[model samples]
Target: MSNESSPLQSSLLVSERMAFKLHRQGMIMETIGKNNAVCNEYPSPILPKERWRYQMVNMYPDSGQCHPFGRR
Candidate 1:
């Protein structure tokens, strides 16, 4: 039909951009728990509002924060 992305695709693109921006701003914490050497390590039992700042368990396969299967 048209050379335009569907609504779902547009939303996904926006989400990706936001995630990238957050990551660049250091607002997205990539690790948690004792293993990470960084000072800004995210809390293990992450609070509700703080949850958005941490990397998603399912997204980071090699992260020590949680297993790729989504278990911490």
Candidate 2:
């Protein structure tokens, strides 16, 4: 509300109504970022939660059987 404030200073000042809204929105976005950050650290797993188990073993078909050169 200061007449003395330059255009840039006035533009950046948060109004009373906008202050609360902006602060709340910023906090929500930060929380969402943190919650999903861990998943981004690793490559996606082949198995979904419903099929994967703590002690489960993954069995692969013979790779060399299909290769034209055969197993090396």
Candidate 3:
């Protein structure tokens, strides 16, 4: 049999990419926050279309403004 993985079985799924992007952003924010002191509470891996996370709860200003998660 041929060796191949289905779309669902792929490691780099859409959700995985989304999470990775979020994590990367968070790490950047944490670094900037430490430097500028404007950022507190490193943002957790964010999800798409999550209005609740839009709030600055323990997060820096305008965090994840690039996309509100649900945006295409």
Candidate 4:
């Protein structure tokens, strides 16, 4: 009898544990822009204005909300 789990099983277990930990910590997931991109790196909540400026500049360029035009 093998006592080892398959790679997929291990990964699933890890993911489940991570989700449980996040839920227990009251860490809710959220998106920063219209693109619905996930952001979980920051432990603290960032201001919506700051996030909008950052995401807009990083994700969009032709919109003119960044660089020399917007200077944000």
lDDT of each: 0.45, 0.33, 0.45, 0.41
lDDT of 4 at 28: 40
Q: lDDT (0-100) at residue 28 of candidate 1?
A: 59
* Candidate 1 ranges with C-alpha deviation above 4 Å: 1-3, 32-72
Candidate 3, superposed: residue stretches over 4 Å from native: 1-4, 27-41, 44-72
Overall local distance difference test of candidate 1: 0.45
Per-residue C-alpha lDDT of model 4 across residues 26-64, encoded as one tens digit per residue = 574454445557544433232222332222234335664
For candidate 4, the clash count comes to: 0
lDDT of 1 by residue, 1-72 (tens): 144357534544455556556666667564644655645554233222334433344544755552121122
lDDT of 3 by residue, 1-72 (tens): 124255432422454465667776775233237567575676655433344222224546665553333332
| lDDT (tens digit, per residue) of candidate 2 on 1-72 | 476366433433333224345444553122223476553333222222232212212546544432111111
Worst 10 residues of 1 by lDDT: 63-72
Error of 1 at 30 (Å): 2.0
Which segments of candidate 2 are over 4 A away from where they belong?
15-20, 25-27, 31-72
Candidate 4 deviant stretches above 4 angstroms:
1-4, 29-72
The true-structure Cα RMSD of candidate 1 reads 11.7
> Model 4's lDDT to the true fold?
0.41
